[model samples]
Target: MKITVSNWFKSGSPWVWLNAGAVAVSVVMVLGLLALIAVRGLGHFWPTAIVAADYTIPGNSQVQVMGQIADVEEIPAQRLVDAGLPKPGNKALIDRQLIKVGNRDVSGSDFVWVVKPWLQNVSHPKDAIALERREWGNFYGFLKDVRQNGSVVASGTEAWAALQDSIERAEDIYSQIYKIEKKEIGHINSGLERLRLKERSLELKGTNTPEALADIAASRAVLDAEYKVLEKELGDLYAAFTRDSIQAQTIDNNIVDINVSKIVRAYQPNAMGFFGKVGFYGDKIWEFVSDDPREANTEGGIFPAIFGTVMMVIIMSIIVTPFGVIAAVYLREYAKQGFVTRVIRVAVNNLAGVPSIVYGVFGLGFFVYFLGSHMDQLFFPEALPSPTFGTPGLLWASITLALLTLPVVIVATEEGLSRIPSTVREGSLALGATKAETLWRVVLPMASPAMMTGLILAVARAAGEVAPLMLVGVVKLAPSLPLDGNYPFLHLDQKFMHLGFHIYDVGFQSPNVEAARPLVYATALLLVIVIAVLNLSAVAIRNHLREKYKALEI
Candidate 1:
């Protein structure tokens, strides 16, 4: 072989060959992400649609669970956004509660509202329901009733649905009232005409004229009173019809008697746009997300879990970043290279090596039952015995994660600081810049990219680490979200829902294991997406900071 001048273009050394292998790894990673996303997303599209039969429920009532069919509303993409509420406008558009029953076309406005994930052959379907009764009703028929009103209440889908039965009933009543009012008024008018004719006859009377006048006058007065009553009734009818006060919601009386006035209950397709429904795929997605925060199958949706995840991550980041950065700065710039530094370095590295499950045990023992219970006694006395800080809290979870990831942040930050030249620091001191000022302005900026990278990695690792969180902050189900409808309502003490736990519960602890498998894939897809998003954000930030520093490199 010719000993050509060695260059990158022609290099065949093992290191160069390894560099080439990196390209293959990159290709594999990209393909893997794509394939996983497709598998999860398509799984959402092809959800099992199993129709449930009418089974006898408690109190001798029968509930029918149709099946879990493609909602026609479910769309594509992995990693679903949070589905946490019963919000009215576009907010409720993401709910995948509507099922595509039989040949029903969901794209057009014509539909019958059906319960999502139509429960099939369950001993009890009530245990899985999150909303009021969902039965077959003509969604289009309700719209027709609204057209007769020619108002928002008339033309509106939800509004008409809300009062469909009442509107139809009101229309009927008004029709009857229209005929009765006309007939009663006609009768009264005729009576008045007869009374006038009688008066004329009395005036023409000879011996009996005066006696007839008194009797006729008495009859006329009674007829006039009757006319007044009819007029008032007509007026009341018109007023009631005009204000839409008489419109009522109609459901299968056989199913539920939802009093629209006193205790109004409404069904809504809990999703919006084409894509959102596509993501929701089958009603099972809806079933998977919803719950009352206690039962496993309740359709309250994974709102609590989402809130917990975001809130905990934010808290963890806040706690870990400053502390980790400060420790790194002190070790790199201020601490003498003696026993203290050596000891700290060993401790920091050792902390990283410790198993994550150990941290969870620590959190549960020290944080939950001990520290949290103590705080419950002092600060939240009213909520005591319930264990405020003593229980798994988002705050505690965040703190726990912060503790677990601190070493990674510190190590990365210290390495970044060490890369800064000693000459630069000496020059800064010679230029009369204080150590603190130089470190703050020059050192930190240079090290920020690395710190951010560390944080990114920490977030990626922490978000996926279910074992530690399983012990500390996360719960199988949270009753109310950590945030709620109270004054200054974001409660840190509250236990939170988590997607990881959902995967665990659905995969292992669920009664309907076969039904829950698709959900497990969907959840796994979501977790992967969440991790990717965090990592991508870090990569973007690092790139931007690197660009900013490149100009300073010369």
Candidate 2:
């Protein structure tokens, strides 16, 4: 038996089992981490019940506290005593609860921590509505009355019904206002700026004729008249939106009139059925995916970050694929296998190990400063001192990332090219095919799956890259998307938001850490999903190509 066991170890069976165990452990750890992130991130959208309770503090009067239970923890009773709180008799641990008593404008803070030992009479109040606002985080209060133009329009049970109706109208109006201001007004502004630039250009050429000046003036007048009409319409919309308000009694027993226009949605989580909660959860998820961020990025959605990340990746892919493929083709196929080639290969491999921030600094100095400054001087002198292309933007960011990931693509493609049988190339040449033709028609096609593998790897690296992007183009809060209804439709010169940067900003830079924590998890999860989707797409394409050329290679 001892000899058999020793033979098994000598035969490497034990080593095989050890390696397998290691892999299994690694997979389990990754899955566990993902499960944790998913639970913490996705659970944030659930409609948690609002609790109304009388919180009693030792040596102080009791006050009514109302809000959603955000978190709970157990602390040493001695710590509470050290903080000047009267100790509970012989208790080693005391429970503490974090309540999200939002109504920041009224309560002066969005969250508060209360000791559970001093609390009593906690109840979930169905009438306590949680208001998601467009401005100040959220409001937890009881609906008392609905007012219109400073008059009481509805009160008691009727107020809830009235509030619902008013919010629908306000949201509709808000959409219209957004369209007019962002679309109509924005177009006019662009047109006006272009005309100014055109006139300036003509002046520089000493061709600022009276007729040209008159034509520009005529266009300006037309745009001005259009702007006035939109301005008046916008004013009317604002007035109508602010006309209705709801009188709500907060947890602290203070009455405040909240404008209906500011309220995004109102819900009584305690009153919601299971199905109602599900529907609410779905809506919250949609809002997180579709809406723009607000309230210092502690509230609202991250649509811009999503859009920017996807768009940047697409742009980077476009820029990187061709350049990387061409470089690899030259190095592996055309270049002689000599000392110079070896040196170049070594340099390419070394670049892959360089820190990403080093790339950021290089991108900022070379792409944004050197190349962009030259382009602005030549093409956009009219916008000089202000800097058009002479700034970090989508184009520079894409180019920078393309350069950063170029080595991966080059190395992968070279490996693919090297794997092809020499006989395949020789056979093509023997069959009246030139080297170029053989490479283009036969070698490249068989190598396509490998090239796609490189692209998948490139995208995986680029999608989560935050450091380089910060110096290149990523911003905390981009006012508009890089792609829009504006002229040219895709503005490569615009600075854009990014999911990785959003996670970084919200996680570390936010003023409200507690509120932003869940968002960080959510955004991180979203970024992982985005990268996975991109890689899966590339992998699918690669699989198809591999199957198509399998017989050819054989």
Candidate 3:
């Protein structure tokens, strides 16, 4: 039997095929994007061999260059000619290489572009070293000597091993210093501040008695003594940290002395084998996830950003879920189905389409400025003028996101409630079950999967939101996390870092574009992973709930 085209259309097979094709295309696109992101981002951790080359400009003498080849591209010869660069004869396209010459303090630039035709005698020297620093970016050179107290203690073949030993010592000292400065000293400072605030509160209440003053003074003295002890320990550590230095010879043959404390790691990339490179890559990836960021967030780990993002999402979930469920129940189960109810539903749906930044503005005005200011005035008057609760912070950011995603939860729950057979309600009523009891014991449990579905959507949306968070609380860098071991533990009033904001800052706001570029990709990939993990957790819970209630659906 011949199938007519009209009959095929009538059978809906064409539409089904079209939909499947569209879905296939979409999945492929998504996977392709993820693959691209992974390649660009993850590859940044791998150590590339440093190339030592002689580069000659069109009208200048040959110059020695040492660095890793960061990127290579072909550009139209005409474009180079237009920019007053002499084009190599008869070539339509010129291949240019971007070299990351990381002695930023000396060369004044992290990267330089060189035309391929002008590069001569390129070789990777075995002795060449790449130093990852805590500041001034990376340094590419050769180790000359290891110095102790400005005197050469090790040189020639012995220098590398000695340098490694010194770096280990310095790192240990550095860790101690970090603990003292960031944790012990920090705790003391917080205590002092609280004491000061208490004193101020007493004064404000006209209770500044001599006994109260004595108590405050005694507390301040104890804190001051602790700080002094930490200060002395920090000084000793710093002295040890700066005791050793390394002399490195740059491409220009100039020897520069770098303190051991400033160096994060030094490696001879040219001498590394595949396994060595793999080990180095693993270390770099670990550092990216575990270390604190340095150099305007272009370098170091994004652990703080990851922490803040997860914490905010969790807080937002906690706040939005119950409120959303309640509102949904009221609308679907109790409210009369009339013009007012329909209007309310319409308004809720429309809100889901509103621009996220608008929610930020509303949250700032209503939640932060008005409500938060009132909260500060009422409860935290001692911390007044500092704007404790009356500021953009973790709590405000979470609340803002909760509000932004509330409509989704409400709509989803209402739909779930609507899907229950009316006979289920009738059966419950016939069995002498109260409405509240039925909702608590039967209705809500069955609707939990839908609620979880709504939460998944909310998290997927909220986790990726950068614009609202920017206005509410997210910052370029947060010194401390919102949740800490401090009193009242989860300090919701603290401003915090976020992966989304970190990506934006690294991508756009950084001074070193070349250095920051790879980091942008890495951060974006991490943010996507974080969102996926959060969503998957919710999805798993949702699936479990659905399976648990499957028998009751009839």
Best by TM-score: 3
lDDT of 2 by residue, 415-478 (tens): 9998999999999999999999999999999999989998999999999999999999999999
Q: What lDDT does each candidate get?
A: 0.61, 0.92, 0.92
> Which residue pairs show backbone clashes in model 3?
none
TM-score of each: 0.58, 0.98, 0.98
lDDT of 2: 0.92
Which residue ranges in model 2 land beyond 4 Å of their true spot? 1-3
lDDT of 1 by residue, 1-554 (tens): 66655754466576777988999999999889768765754465332323334434223455543433433453221213233322322332333344323212222221124323232354312211112222221121112223234343433344434354654455565666656554566556657765665564445444346677778778888988988887787787765554443222212212222222221122223223455445545554554344333225322245556556667777788899999999999998889999989999999999998999899899888888888888877765554345657778787788888999999999999988888778778878899999999998877887888899889978887887788888887777665567644433677776786777777877898764443555676666766766787778888998898788765444
Task: Output the better candidate (1/2) by TM-score.
Answer: 2
TM-score of 2: 0.98
Range of the 10 consecutive residues with the lowest summed lDDT in candidate 1: 134-143
lDDT digits (tens) for residues 430-461 of candidate 3: 99999998898889999999999899999999
As a whole number from 0 to 100, the lDDT of residue 54 in candidate 3 is 93
User: Predictions ranked by lDDT, top down?
Assistant: 3, 2, 1
